[model samples]
Each structure stands twice: as C-alpha cells, then as structure tokens.
Target: MDEVLTCENSRVKFFPIMMYAMVMGMSGLTIMYQKAALWLGFTDMIGHLLMMVSTTLFVVISLIYLSKYIKYTPMVKKEFSHPIRLNFFAAISISMLMLAIIYKEVNVNVASMFWYTGTVLHFYLTMYTISFWINNNQELDHSNPAWFIPVVGNVLVPVGGVGFASQGVLMYFFSCGIFFWVILFAILLNRIIFHHQLAVKFMPTMFILIAPPAVGFLAYYKMYGVIDVFATMLFNLALFFTLLVAFMYKNFIKIKFFISWWAFVFPLAAMSISAMLMYHETKDVILLSLSYVMVGVTTMVISVVMYQTVSHVLKGEICVQE
Candidate 1:
C-alpha cells in the first residue's frame, strides 16, 4: 500500500501538470496585446514585453518538464491515458500558435516557422489521442470539456495560418476542427447529463466549452474578413456559453485553488478578443464597451491566479502532484 501510495504521489507531483496553466498566461498576454492595439488604439509596449517573457518561460519550463517526463516512463504512460493530462498537448499546440501570432506582425518568417511546426505537432498529437480513445481497454467514463482540447487546437490553426499558409491548408484545418467540435460537443453533453459528475477540482475546465466557438469566431473573421451569418452564429454560441458558465459561478467559487483554475483564463481571453473583433467589424459601442470590460476582467483574473500560484509555490504546496 505504501509503495502504491508513493507511486501515485509521484505521478501527481511530476506530471506535465502546469503546462496548461502556463499556456493561459501566454494566451492572456497575447490577447492583451490584441486588446490594446485593436480596441484601445495603443501600441501596448508592456503587452509585447510580457508576451516575450511568457514565451521564454514557456520554452524553458517545457524543456525542463519534457526532460523530467521522459525519465519517468510510468508517468509518461499515465499522461497519455489520463483525460486531464492529455489536454497538455492542446496547451503545447496553443502556446506555439500564440508565439506565431505574436511574432507575425514583428517577424513573418519566424512566425511561419512556429506556425508550421505547431500545425504538424498538433496533427500528430490529435491522431495519437484519438487512437488511444479507440484502442484503450478502459471505459470511456472520464470524458470532460478537456476532451475538446485536441480538436480545439485545429480550430485555432487558422488564427495564424491565414497569414502564413495557403487558403487550402487553412480550410482543411478549419473544417476538421469544426467537425470534431460538433461531435465532441454532443459526447461531452451526454456525459455531463448521464455519467458521473465531474469532480469539483475539474469543474473549472467546463469553461473550456467556450473556447472552440470563441476562437473559431476569431479564426473565421481572419479567414473571410466579414462577420457573415456563420461567423455571427459562432460568436453568439460563444456568448451563450460564456453566460451559461457565468451562471455556474457559485459552483466555481466553492472549489479550492488548483492549477486547473487557470483553465478559466484563456477561454475568457479568447472571448475578449472575439468581442474586440466584433466591435471592430460593427463599430457597435456596446461591443466596444464589452471588449473593454472583458479585457479588464481577464487581466484581473489572471493576476489573481498568478498571485495565488506564486504563493503556493513559495509555500511548497504546489510541488506535490494532486
């Protein structure tokens, strides 16, 4: 029993545990830049500086975590099969894409490199994740919003791809992403309705349900340069999910702090960006005001999470795997 406990403890501590949260930090900074430039009509020098810092941290931390993950074969196997841990691949892909988007305005060649690399990596990771779903002997009772991560990465591809890749490539990725989002949305809704309830610690990931359509709206706008009926539908769906999640705020408040709390950050940031895009397109003062409100809210939430995370680290509470 002691041996098994120790193994389980180690698995919790050293898992690719915090990468997804780190990606939230990265995405927040990127969206900050977008909010500043697109809505506020400023250069956002601070946003740029923070984005670079976040990117550096992502590279260094990822290298360290990957090195450690490679040494622990059992931990690696667990990551592949674990529902929550599997979303780390989505975090990685999104982080790479965030880098590409941040750099695209500053350096197109470098942006292209990150974009292509992330696209290839995300494709293989999606395949591997799906293959596991098909072949694993375990029951599929653990489905959650995090399951959308793999396919969500595809929806996000065109965020940077529209500028760096061909139209054909962009359409292929967008179609795959949207298709899977439909299928997974059904599967996850069924699980929520009929299967075991998600643990309190994981309820924060339900915010992930907002990301596909929010990011998809932004990506569609990038590709087509118009908020057509489809784009309107995507944006409205994201808005509906955002409000729906907000109505569940009391449930979120009851849960204690965990790295998974960061799951709330990026999705909010994506919605903020979507709002800013809407404001730009329609010149609607209401959306413009909403964009400002969302930027402030996202910044505050991320700030609070960063503070709590640092406090935990200093107290050595975050070192153990939970």
Candidate 2:
C-alpha cells in the first residue's frame, strides 16, 4: 500500500509539457464565446464563466508543472530535447497569448503584460525549435501537426498585439508565421500521404491543420481592418480544412481519448471565431449560420474533452511514461 501511494505521488514528475494545451483549449473557448456574445447577441455570462475557469486552470497547472520542473529537472530537460515534445513547449506561450487576448478587454494593462511576455517567449522558442529541426537528423514520421505550435505561432501575435505593439513588429511575426506555415504544411502533407498514418495517440492532432489559415485570417483582419482577396483566400483555406476534418469525424470518434484530444478544441475555436469574423465583415446569412454551427460544435467538444480529462486524471491514466 505504501509503495502504491509512493508511485501515485511520483506521477507528478511525469507531467507532460503538452498539458498546457488544456489552457489553450479553454482559453480558445473563452474567446470563442466572447465573440459569439458580440456577434450573435448572446449573453456574455458564458464567456465570463469560461474565462474564470480557464484562468484558474492556468494558474493551477502552471504551479503543478513548475513543481515538476523543480523536482525532476533532468526529466524536464529530456523532454525538451525530445523531437516531439520540443514542439509543445510553445503551448505554454500560446496559453499566455490566449490569456492576453481574453484579458485585453477586461484589463489592458494585464493583457499587455501577458502579450509582451508570451510574445518574447514564443519568439525564442520559435528560433530554438526551427534551429533544432535544421540541425538535427530527425525521422520523417516525426513530423505531426504539433510542429505548427512552435514557429507558426508567430501568426497569433498580431491578433492580440495590434494596439500594444508597433505595426512593424506585428508584421514581422505575421510574415514569419505565414511563410513558415506553407513550408511546414507541405512537409506535413507529404508525411501524411507518403508515410504511415499518425499513431492513434496523435491522430487527434490532425485538427491542428485547421489553425494556420483560420488564425491567419483573424490576425490579418485584426492588423489591417479589411477583408481583401488575400484575406478571403486564408479564410477559404481554413474552411476547406474544417470540412475535411469534419468528414473524417468517423475515424476520430473511434479512437480512445488521449490528452491530444484537446487538440480538437482550439483549432475549431479558431475556425468558429473566423466564421464569426467573416459574418461580422460580410453580414452574409450563410456565414452567420456557419458561425452558429461552429460555435455549437466547438463548445460541445471542449466540454466533453474537459470532462474526459478529469475522468482520466482520476483514473491515473495521464502523465504516465510512454
């Protein structure tokens, strides 16, 4: 009994970096509902409730992960060096970025702090992650949509950085994100078509493929305040991927739950928000209906995943060695 208790206590040492994805999903949902409130005339109560819950989760998870880092420093370093886990380090910064956006309206000063910190951290990780990819001899099958988390995260800066940072600064990150996205996307496509399918545990990460164009559309519109031909292309590309993923839903539903299932939440949140943005800009009735549908699906998915995560944690199914 003592040994079993000791093992249970040790589980915290294996806390994975990708766990930050929870904050990303929750924050994405918070932002999604907030946008729905503005665009669809829904009560902001749901948005506020989600914000409070996500913020609390962020704080609690941060503390727990920090403890893991402090006590299991070598294990943390090993995960950092692992080709796959390295990409997820950016989830930490992405969580901060999402929080920054959520708080921008509630408190600009707080939001500005999160934006600056998240921007600087993500930028460093981008350089390091890309450099790691260039320098290392990595396997082709190692490439997954999680690769997008590090460098392509540059696209996220502009959405929250508009008034807080200079236009040139925002433009620099946006360009890097977009340029890298296409290059990495081609590589990911080749892997999917030529290489073996992603492992069952990672299949859910396919959802990440939806984020770039959807988020790019949002960031671009935020920077320019206009919907031009290029913006239309980005939004359309996102919609295409969204449809593709939805078509694959049968395959996804058969897979067992992994924390990677959280991957399903945030990209749909981006697409849902993108749909709302398109409606806000075009006021097209179809776009409004799409936004409604996306919002409903995203909200339901996040709620379900959150419940599954809690269930798994209680079962001690998460944070185990692979």
lDDT of each: 0.77, 0.92
lDDT of each residue in 73-147, candidate 1, tens digit only: 677677767865776666787777778887787789988888898898889888888887788664546777887
Model 2: lowest-lDDT 10 consecutive positions:
1-10
| TM-score (C-alpha) between model 1 and the true structure | 0.91
Best by TM-score: 2
Which candidate comes out best when scored by lDDT? 2
lDDT of 2 at 98: 93
- For model 2 the local lDDT of residue 147 reads 95
Residue 316, candidate 2: Cα error in Å is 1.2
